[model samples]
Target: MISSLKRFLIGRPLKSTELGEQRLNKKKALAILSSDALSSVAYGPEQILIVLATVGAAAFWYSLPIALGVLILLIALILSYRQIIFAYPHGGGAYMVSKNNLGITPGLISGGSLLVDYILTVAVSVSAGTDAITSAFPALHAHNVMIAVFFVLFITLLNLRGLTESATILAYPVYLFVVALFILIGVGGYTILTGQVSPELHTPMGTTVTGLSLFLLLRAFASGSSALTGVEAISNAIPNFKEPAPNNAAKTLIAMGSLLGILFSGIILLAYFYGIAPSEEVTVVSQIAEGVFGRNYVYYFIQGTTALILILAANTGYSAFPLLAVNLAKDKFIPRMFTIRGDRLGYSNGIIILGFLSILLIIAFKGRTEQLIPLYAVGVFIPFTLSQTGMMVKWFRERPKGWLPKLLINSTGALISFSVTLIFFLTKFNQVWPVLIFIPIMITLFKKIRKHYDEIAEQLRISTCEEATPIQGNIIIIPIAGITRVVENSLNYAKSLSPQQIIAVHISFDKEEQKKLEEKWGQWQTGVRLVSLHSLHRSIIQPLTKFIDSIERRTTGSNYQVTVLIPEFIPKKGWHHILHNQSSFLIRTVLLHRKNVVVATVPYHLKK
Candidate 1:
């Protein structure tokens, strides 16, 4: 029944041969894998306005320029990764690329960074998704953390249902979100082009800081680059695409990049022209929608779709992180458990771990999108820089037909991403440091795991000393407390194991009890040797432990096996065991530690 329920929830387990059925085409892949980049438009422009707002409304003039700069970086990343798709078609994300070209240490670092980035993608996306709803209805503000966590769990369960199923489930939201935004831009654009622009769009005031400095502009650009976080995912999970994987992945990458660029630039300019600023009660996009459509049905539609798409965007991490974990496990940098697919052929361990880590982040950050925003951009950029840097090295070494352009393009991406990473560290040091520190610790853990696996592999290899030899015979010792049916059953089973020698032993605290057991054994004529040991301490486990230890000493270098048969009666009801003491458990625990000892339990259930 339990297995049936699992099947019902996650679908029937797939055969390893069915992996091809799970491979997605470009359209579904775009919706499944590109949701992260697509959903970032909901917050990327707002992040710019948020940082710019620190300098007050006057400094908001730089929002367009900062967003445009991020747009350029996004394009460079897409172009660079397109070359990556063809060069390393077998799903070479930053970790694999860096490992192939740079070295093991850089590869480990890139893996750690990308893992953190994927976790943060889930956390940040879900939190921002919850924020979209809260912005639409302030009454739900208090439940934001709960809402965000629920979204993560829901997406996790969806992915566990299998890739194609989840892609189908979540694909509609991406289209709805895109359609809603286009409608918003169209209606809002009409407002601006016509004389119907709200007069407030042209007015400005509220200068918190006196001057607009390069530091503040750089800070704004750093924040806006959050949009670039999900670009590498397509590269990371390129293998999930159908045949002609490289071209499909490249086309999808270009399309996602182009769409995000359009949406981000359009939204930034719209928000800029519409006089929308970061609000404690509403999102920047929410404000823009309302400012254009007023408090009407279209406004609610935009808000609802935004919330759905933002929440579903976390599906991007679900779809990609598992594949990354599987690859890492194959490299032996993590536990082998991740290599096994679940009922739906998803990497259940990785998806579940990502969900839990994201839950912690949501709870720790109180589910506020702005609170998590500062820490969100750095983890992703590390991989971006490393991936491009490695790709440039690949171009130079491989010297493919178009190596020069690809190398220059990747070099440009590497420099910009590295610069952004540095600038972000300076701007958001307090938040960035935790991730930076955590990354090295993760790399160290990976190295330790790899080292342990290597040692274990060498040890488990064919060796003469530990080679198997058939068991010559068995000496069974039955710890008989008193003559009972359970003991009778244990002795009968022991005779089958080896009728040559079976000893029924009793640890008695009183001579009277020992004498009674000896007489009873004589009457039963069980053909089992009766051995009695006096226990002044009245402890059952200690004396039994000593007997096993003495046997181990006698058999020092021999293959003679010593089996300790512990007779235990099964109670009619489970709770009846609480009424009866668990001495057999104690005896087995004590005997298990002895050399050449096999502890076995024989149970005779009561007919009650």
Candidate 2:
């Protein structure tokens, strides 16, 4: 029933051969991959306002310059990552680039940073999307966290359904958002040209708090850099594109960067002309929409599409994070399960884990975009800087054609990205300190996992075994609670292995029970030896494990393995298993650490 329900929701599981068809075309790729960077315009200008607002109304004039600065940096990063795409086209994300060029430690650090950043991306995007709704409806403000969590879960389910399915479904909202933003820009530009600003927005322009300073300008620039967080995702997910994958991915990057530049600068200008100020009550985009559309249906349409696009923007993180995790797993940094494809051929483990982490951030921050924004760009910028640095190093080593110019470009980008990383640290260290703590923990974990794998490999290394080597003898020890059908089946299966001897060991907590079982075994004449033991403390696993240890110590034969056969009964229904204590589980848990001891479970399914 569970499998049928899962099939119903995500469709039938695709075979491994069906994975090749999951590639996305350019148009659908843009809709799925670029949403995070593109939808960021909804709040990018407002973040600048948040920083500059500290210096009062005069600082508002500098908003355009700060945004332009961010744009210049954006183009530089796009060019740098374009090189990244051409050079390491098999999805040259920070993890791969840094690990390849810099080393494993640097790679894992960048990977950890990106992992944290993507989680924050979902949190911030969902919170910002909820902020849009609350700005319009007002009454929904109290339910922001709940709404953001629901959106995260919704995106997770959509992703698990399959990649192409989610991308196709999300394409419309992205298109709608782009169309809505352009309409706002066009109508707002018309309003400016006509010199007919709304009365509600065009108020007295006076100094209220303080004077503008260079510090405020830099802060605004740093905050506005959030717009570039998801820009590198295109390069990271190059494999997901259709044939001519690298070319398609590069084109998509340029397309996204162009849209981001135009809309971001255009929105800031509209807000400037309309005199939209950053307010605690509503978003700057909300204010601009109202100024242009005048509380009409277009205003609500803009609001609804803005919310939709922002929520769906989490899809960008969902697309890239899992793929990055798969890369990390291949390097043995994270769990191997992340590399395993789900029934739908999607990285469902990473997707579900990302959803849960994003929801935790939602609950922690109460779905406040402002609070989450401080923690946002820090993660991405760390990777951005490292990826560029890795490329810069790569160019000098490989000295590919046009190395000098490409080298200079990546170096410049690295400098700029490094500057932003430092700025994020200085400006919002309190908010972003968690990332600082997280990276080292992940690095330590990676080393430990590597150590364990290395040790296990060494231990399991096989000696030279010629074809003349004879089969080794083995002994089977069966632990049974009674003379039931489950025991009969277990002994019969043990006979198939052709063990030299089969011994049935029963642990009795009561003396009377032990004697009764021994009498019954004698009467049955089962041929298998019945070894009865008394447990004074009523401990089943402890006494049984000791008996196995005594046998291992007494065994004199070489090239022989000691095996313990555990008999288990499977109930007719899933819930019925819970009615019985899981003795087999306890036995294996203790015996797994012992050397040369194998515990095998033999099951007899019960009919109701």
Best by TM-score: 2
Model 2 per-residue lDDT tens digits across residues 118-237: 888888898889989999999988888888989998999999999999988999999999999999999999988887876455434443336666666677888999888899898879
Error of 2 at 581 (Å): 2.0
Worst ten in a row by lDDT for model 1 = 200-209
Give the alpha carbon lDDT tens digit for every residue of 377-420 in model 1. 78888888998999988888989796898889999999999999
Worst 10 residues of 2 by lDDT: 200-209
The C-alpha stretches of model 2 lying farther than 4 A from their native spots are: 198-210, 463-472, 556-559
